[model samples]
Target: MDLSDKQQRPVPQGPRIDRTFFRQNKKINKINKLKNKIILVRVLTEILLGALRIVHKRNTRAP
Candidate 1:
């Protein structure tokens, strides 16, 4: 069957967790999870850096 034919086919009405499908889905899920984690870490790091900079500025001008 052609790729377009596959695309036009109706979605399965029941769960069919075959090996290849499971593997690919798991891989894609891991990639998405990792990407989200990386984004969260980056945002947190930026916020912490900004706070530290502000604190440093205040401390330097205190004395």
Candidate 2:
């Protein structure tokens, strides 16, 4: 028997996340956030140190 186009068409399911998979995804997201925070802090600290070095050199030259 030949199936009609409508009958052969597949049903569409929207995105679905199972419980275990969702939990794992949340854990990974948390880890990524922490890694980003650490990188941002390290970059800011380097910039501050560079500014301090510049200020120190100017202060020493002014005397």
Candidate 3:
């Protein structure tokens, strides 16, 4: 019985650790996705603003 208990103890512990690790990994993935989205938005806005500036310059020079 003692040997059986010892063997069974490790089995449950293994899955418990895996579950917590999986949860942590999920959280990290979500945060990374959000960060990537924010960076993409910032880059797009910068490009749009630069284009607007260029257009404004051209219009002013033409007039």
**Cα-based RMSD of candidate 3:** 13.5
Best by TM-score: 3
Pairs clashing within candidate 1: none
Q: Across residues 1-63, which tens digit of lDDT does each residue of candidate 1 receive?
A: 122322232333567645666566556666666766899999999999999999999999956
Query: Over 4 Å off in model 3, which ranges?
Result: 1-17
| lDDT (10s digit) by residue, model 2, range 1-63 | 222323233334568646666566556666666766899999999999999999999989955
Model 3 residue 40 lDDT score: 95
**Colliding pairs, model 3:** none
Runs in model 2 with CA error above 4 Å? 1-17
lDDT measured at residue 8 in model 3 versus the true structure, 0 to 100: 25
Question: Given candidate 1, what's the lDDT at residue 14?
Answer: 60
lDDT tens per residue, model 3, 3-60: 2322122323543466766566566666666766899999999999999999999889
Could you tell me which residue pairs clash in candidate 2? none
